[model samples]
Target: MVKMLCDPVCPPPNLSQHPCCTVKCWKWDVNQITMNNLVKYGILILNRPITQNSGFIKNLWNRATIRMTVDGGTRQWDKFISGLSNEMQTTIKDPDLISGDFDSITDEILEKYKAKGCKVIHTPDQDRTDFTKAIMELNTHRKQTGLELSHIIAVAQTSGRFDQIVGNIQTLFLVKEELLLDPNTNVFLISDDSITWLLMPGDHVIYIPEETRQHKRAWCSLVPVGETCKYCTTTGLKWNLDNQSLRFGGIVSTSNTFDGSEKVTVKCSHTLMWSMRLPTIAIS
Candidate 1:
């Protein structure tokens, strides 16, 4: 068993320092998850090299060191690779790495990132998407860098095969508690304090930022596998729901706006997923 020595100011000597005390066993009774953890390192993982439409490419231009993994898809590989060149030039300025099996990836694009000295490793695992492998690689990098894995803004995680999307999200639930990821694991979002992960069946409050401010988009959500949420209560959205029961077939909250300015709270009788977006910032 791992032991922790905690002082108010400094952490224990020679002990692993997690971004939050939640990773380690804490003696203090914390009421709920908050947004305080967003201030630290924010890691973004993109599954498959970006497919840049004119609009999507422009939006991703500002992000730094985007580690991308290309997938082996049934789509037209040549056309995808040819179209990506110009967009890669326009949107990606950082040393973005491209990795995955070469089945769907072209020789031209592989040479491009490689020539630029971006680290590339080809792991042709048939059991998982290249995306899943990339996430594991990022986890290893996180441990090596001594940074806790944060919000992963993954593209193509859901847009690919329907089964793949479900599988990727399912992996989120299996993540060890110490890893501490946002509820929507495959999305590019984060919280300032802490993201509330689901529990079995009980009443719990999730802290959220109130909407009445400058930002119009403040909230987002994901349904857990099987989507068996019996009931949920939220206090931050523009439309408040009390004792509302939601399931797989019902309304799945994807893009919900916030109403308050400071923080909103959520209570659920069953396990539920809720996440807030964070501004894109660079980490060293």
Candidate 2:
């Protein structure tokens, strides 16, 4: 008999002898929701300001295998790293690709990365934002040249202009069609304070990483995001839903805590945007 993904038990225990044993069952995409099942994806750093000491940046930098920058993002990165020690400055964090409309990336920033053997691509299309162009490039390469990318983690602040925030969310909707080749390609928008992602029209389970939920009261909110989400059911949230209809002006779930649960599951008719607070260090 074939053992199911959750056979034996949930979240395989890490053996002391083999530290990497914690990565068991990570290769299978259909495995039960767990932090060990996190898929490797290319990191897309946006132009938004991200300080060097940001926990979100620290986490992604260690996790992502590939890194790319969007337009003026290089400027933000350059400025951020410049404040570090000389040893850290000497250690290069060269991006594999820097893409945008060329309006945001300064000439100095481009020259600096170019000297470090970075591939700077100038997409002059005015029809789309640099954010959208980056996605298109990722999709194009995936289809034509077999660029291996499971998904994308976009690191841009939510404190930017309201229009910019909407535009970033729009990319999530547009990329849905392009990523149909892989159902596990979940794109997430992460920042210093929170993480936001779109849950499709099916059962969705979000595994909160151990490091992200320790001793922190995380508030999660669900929004339809430009559509009326109907008949949604959820478990493991403070305000659990049961076949509920949520709309922009009608009913939306906000300020809902996680109730100290490791996993939050939602089944919905329409795609709903899920936003959760980031666990942070308490500075007394």
Task: Report lDDT per candidate.
Answer: 0.43, 0.67
Best by TM-score: 2
Over 1-284, each residue of candidate 2 has an lDDT whose tens digit, in order, gives 21222122122121333344332122212211122233356778898887424433544554665678889888887777776678766654678788998787779889989999988888999887888888777666566756556557787877869899999998887766444324445567866667787766656666654544554566779999877987899877878999999997888999787666677778777778888765542111
Which one is best on lDDT?
2
Q: lDDT of model 1 at residue 28? A: 12
What TM-scores do the predictions have?
A: 0.54, 0.80
Q: Model 1 off-target regions past 4 Å?
A: 1-66, 72-92, 145-149, 157-161, 176-222, 249-262, 275-284
TM-score of 2: 0.80
Evaluate model 2: give its lDDT: 0.67
**Residue 197's lDDT in candidate 2:** 75
- Candidate 1: tens digits of C-alpha lDDT, residues 1-284: 11111111221211234334232211211111111222222333344334434233333333322444444421222233456567564554433445567676567766766776767777688776565666666666556667543245444433556776566555444443334333223223222222223332333333333321235444456454454666766665677667777677776666676665344445444445654443222110
lDDT of 1 at 95: 34
